[model samples]
Target: MIYADDSGHPASGLVLYGWIEFSPDHWAPVLKSWLDLRKRLWRDYGIPVTQELHATQFVNGRGRISQRIPPRFIHRGVEYWKDFGREVAVQCLETLRSTEGLTVGAVWRRRSPAELAQTKSEAYSALIRRFEDELAEADSLALVFMDGDGSDSSYRKSHRSLKLAQRRVIEDAIHLDSRSSQLIQMADLVAWCANSSVDRHPGNHFASEWYSTFLAERDPCRSPREI
Candidate 1:
């Protein structure tokens, strides 16, 4: 199966969609490793594994980690922990690189929501085409998983129709909560990092590294046209 997630607000200047594709054979090992990484976050950094692997929250130091900081250092502490959190994300991504039977892809564009919506069909066509290409190379009929809450119904219907029309390329598209799956979380990480790469204001140097790392190994599915 392929787990997918998106990063950046549609209204933002940059938006990214990322996915991790792996076969049934490798799913267990990858998932187990991810779970182990969560444990390591607690053991190594005292960060709870139960906390969602949310990029924005980690960057902003909001949610669970906020309560753990002392009032005196809350501001600086959050910044410090945010860096640590980003490091953990980078480490997790690096580990996933070594796993067999996995390929990652991202499609990003620098355009506002209005511009994208103006040509949504064309964008979907390019993305679906690139996904099918990956499936073809893998020789696998996979289900594409993403968060239903993040997907618009009309867009989902249109995407479904497109995939179904292609015949055996994708088995189906499944939507589940990102919190429910570690793989989905990983997808989120990729999306988040990729967005950071292009976000000049964020000042995250690792974002470009992470973005290049994922794209280096696979053919990225870009918008306006497949690449």
Candidate 2:
């Protein structure tokens, strides 16, 4: 199965859409580790388990995390937590690496004015092509779970087209809330690291190093393909 997510603004430098796949044997153990991490985050760090670990939110110290810090230390604390979140994400990716049947695939496109004026077809195309390539290489059928609630008509339309074309490789593209899956959250981190690496964002201290971790475990569709 594959859990997918996207990072970066379409109007910005580069938008990355990617997925991480796990074989049946490795899925359960990785999931258990993720679940255990979630529990520890709640118990040790006092982060609520339900607060989704989106890379941007954690890095920027927005959302529920703001409530957890004192105003005087908010600025410095956010920076620390941002690094901490990066560490957590790195650990999550490493956990996936410790298993077999794990694959990471992504597609990225630099957004132009014209592309931004329309739908995010390029982003969808990047993910679809990489996913198809991986499935063909593995010669296995799988289902895709993407981060969304099926609310975006444009995305739905693109997904339909992609699915129709690659029915032999993919079983379905199911829209889901990103908050609900740890695997999807890891995909979010991968995309986030890709974006930070491309843009050289100031807050991206760990992205460069973490990228090597990605390469170490990346599958056949190894690196993020440029569109």
Candidate 3:
């Protein structure tokens, strides 16, 4: 299975997370659709693929120097982002709805008073439990990814637990001579890409989010160079 997730620190709002899942066969078309939208956006704006653009700047701060654009631009941009996400989500859902040869799951965590009160590790532990439950009944190969806030040192503290969970989930697969599951931390790449925002080619928010889930599900076996 293929999994993707996104993370965001909403201005004056909660930290948020979202994820989607799909099987190998469904990956091509869905990825194509997402790419198509990106291409259209680039073409319309004469944006270059090698560069990126920040969402805030794309709307020109809504006619203000430092403030966000007016509601019209904000609304349009948000709608575009949401529509891009929904299209991929719907495709994934369609493939997994029957659960015939594949099972998929996604989760979202929004920071709340209770969550903030807990230690960062504690909050991550809770999120891990939800992830574990999602794949508990699966018999096929499993892959998991998660988007993380690179700034949260406390969150990274949960890496130990995440590692243990990965081992447990794929132990059976290993015993049967199958590939073991893997986990990855994709925040660095996401952060780099986000910071690289150029003109017109808005930041790849979907890729940033997907990196998390991808890192979470990759095989653990790797060489030092690979890391």
**Candidates by TM-score, descending order:** 2, 1, 3
Off by over 4 Å in 2: 66-80, 117-119, 162-166, 169-172, 219-222
lDDT of 1 by residue, 1-227 (tens): 77877665566645567677777788998788777877776776566766777777775444354324334444643446655556666667766666666677666655666776634444544566666775678665767788556456544654567645554445445777766677888888766766666564546664656666644454344211122
Candidate 2 lDDT by residue in tens digits, 1-227: 87878776555745667667777678887677777777766765666767788877775445444324333344644535554555556655666566456677666677575566343565675566655775778776677778888766665555466646555445446877788777788777767766665556556655755655654357464556676
Q: What shift in Å separates residue 127 of candidate 2 from its native position after superposition?
A: 2.7
Off by over 4 Å in 1: 66-79, 116-122, 137-139, 163-165, 169-172, 213-215, 218-227
The residue pairs in collision within model 2 are: none
Output the number of the lDDT-best candidate: 2
TM-score of each: 0.77, 0.77, 0.41
Cα-based lDDT for every prediction: 0.63, 0.64, 0.34
The number of clashing residue pairs in model 2 is 0
**What are the per-residue Cα lDDT tens digits for candidate 3 across 1-227?**
43333333333223322233456686565455434544544454333333323222232222111122223334534634343333333332232233333222222233454554243345345555554555665644454444433454544454444556354233211111101111111122222222222111344443333323433232121100100
